[model samples]
Target: MARVPQARRQFAAKDRQQARLCAEQRPRAPPKTALGVWGKAAPTPAARRVQDARAHAANCNRSTVVLKRRGFPMMAPGQVDLLKKRGKKLGEGHFSTAVVTRWHGADAVLKAPRQKPNVGQFVKECGLLHTLEGAGGAPEPLGLCLYPLAQVISFAGPQTLAGYLEESRSSAELLRLAADLCGKVSEVHEKGIIHNDLKFDNVIVDGRGQIHLIDFGNANPQGQTFCLVSKGQRCPWLGPEVFSQHLSSPAQDAFSVGFMLDTISKLMP
Candidate 1:
């Protein structure tokens, strides 16, 4: 073959070498996992924190805000006064009525439902409240009075979460509040009890951001029992798994916690 220019031969060799190297290289791609994207095999503390923050934000957005006020008769002027009522009717729904009250030199919330007295419910709620009270962040169960004709427990409180959100509290504060509430509730549920009527109004937050869960008309012992509330009286939140023509279980209470938290996030100011 005719002699080729040295520069041209060198150029050909260089091109061949470049092609071989390119063939040996791995394909470029976007990361397929969190760790991959973050350049670690596992989540770093900072990454975990970001994820937790986002999850918390999502939880707040999904927190339960629908205050069920049904069936709860209006507070008699005397009962309202007796309760040291403070805030205007925070809300009302089909099963219960909520009033902001001041008791024990602190802001409080009192909830009374129109339904007949449920002693099992009462015990469960009181027990849980008492237990949570021990945690300090939970609302203290000051006392419960059974309304003679109304068959309602005039529950005096720790406080209402709604009022706190209404005041436009911060997410950090809210999350901390939620964590405390979750801890208390987890303890309650662990005891094999179900707060069947778990809802937004039932969770009260006070000026100090303490959480108090209320409304126990539907709470039951850990074991199964016949559904007592009239079919029409059922709170929509009582999931089918728990309230399908019957009373709820611990899972139902857990569902309520999830549902309640979901409601809070949406209502968080």
Candidate 2:
């Protein structure tokens, strides 16, 4: 063979090295199996139904027995109705109104749908609260009522972070509150859920200065994709990606936390 130039040989060697590196770095396809590309068989229709039923039963049992064991009993529909008539209105949101009341002699908030169409959202919020039962910084969900479409949850506090921020707060206090909020967000994420709404109004500060996250109506399971429709106003706490891709993730909550911290810093006097 004719003698190859030294530069040509060097170039050929570099090309081979680059090709090998690229091959090594390329993502490998998941191993395929007889059932599916995920290497596991898909559940049959009957099996899927059974799985769903089991999950539903588990949630129902948890909400009833476990909550009762934790000193929060399932209130009867009549009792819930009575509370609605007697309880003091704590606050009102677009979908629901919170009424502060007593449940089994303990402070509780009865959240009822403002309209018939909002019942589904109320139920979802109750479910999310139940899922976060015993979680630090989350209000305990007592139970749900169907007659008037409401849910009773432990009273987090009388003051929201929004109102609390109006008062003069020492730097240490603000830092402590911010830390509590971030810690609460992490706890929610650890439970495999994302608090999509992390604004000041959704956070409650107890008399002891401990922060608790409330208003889980906008929350969704982590990694779920969801579109948030505005109710004639823009949400400042939500990450910009939520508007574009409409995906749910822990990063969204992180962005909200950053916004909160920035706001707190600005308010610091």
Candidate 3:
């Protein structure tokens, strides 16, 4: 009985250590997890089978970007202002609306939180993205900002991972996407940010096969602990630790990446 708790702690510690190493570009083998936390009832990803662009678009869970003017515009620091609202709603979750808007003279997405609590959540995510971006060679996509209007992030190309899977693709292509996603989660963990939410819908791939990870509203900084009494936010990507009401940690992020990789791997024939 004592060894069980001790072993779990050891695994978690190693996960956190791996996260730090990966964030810093120290090459290491990825974590190979046992079925310690995943259960049979956990959500499994479905195979996407569409083969053409038209078919992919039709099959993807997408919303046309709605272009409408807000009565009041949103403004970010650095003189960024909404010049135009672009398209229909790109995506919407329980906490935010992901929409395209012209900001600082470029097209950007407004990941606007829907409520007060969500605002704080978005703010924290923005901070993490900025920090990791700086550490990761100042990547442009990480330049997310909390505008009085919304949390503005760079707009990824059309097609979520699910949609990308639908397009006719090679086995090599599938492996690249999975590997890239694994790298992304590790990169964030290196910075001590736990992405509480990781799913196919949040990952976008362009027509050219470029990958983008978006939406960090549920992320938390290192060492901050939150009680698991809430029910509405749990998703299928989460691990058993989360289901058991433990605090979110870097290990959970690893578990998510593990499942994400497994899910994407099966997309190949």
Q: Tell me, by TM-score, which candidate is best.
A: 2
Could you tally the backbone clashes for each prediction? 25, 0, 5
Colliding residue pairs in candidate 3: 65-87, 65-88, 66-87, 66-88, 67-87
Taking the tens digit of each residue's C-alpha lDDT, what string does model 1 give over 49-119? 99999986664334212111212222344665577435546566555556666555665556556466443
> Candidate 1: minimum summed lDDT over ten consecutive residues — where?
63-72
Tens-digit lDDT track of model 2 for 1-269: 45668778999999999999999999998656358556587777898999999987776666566546655446677988789887998989877888999888898998887766464566567777778874658888787755456788898789989899999999999988888888888888999888887888888888999888888888888888876677565677888776655768898889898998999999776
lDDT of 3 by residue, 197-260 (tens): 6777877776666666666666677667644335676666777665554566888777777777
Candidate 2 yields a Cα-based lDDT of: 0.80
Candidate 2 Cα outliers beyond 4 Å, as residue runs: 1-74
Model 1, global lDDT: 0.57
Off by over 4 Å in 1: 1-159, 226-236, 245-248, 266-269
Where model 3 places Cα greater than 4 Å from the true spot, the runs are 1-87, 116-118, 134-149, 227-234, 243-247
Better candidate number, 1 or 2, judged by TM-score: 2
TM-scores for all candidates: the values are 0.47, 0.70, 0.60
Q: Against the true structure, whose lDDT is highest?
A: 2
How far in Å is the alpha carbon of 66 misplaced in model 2? 14
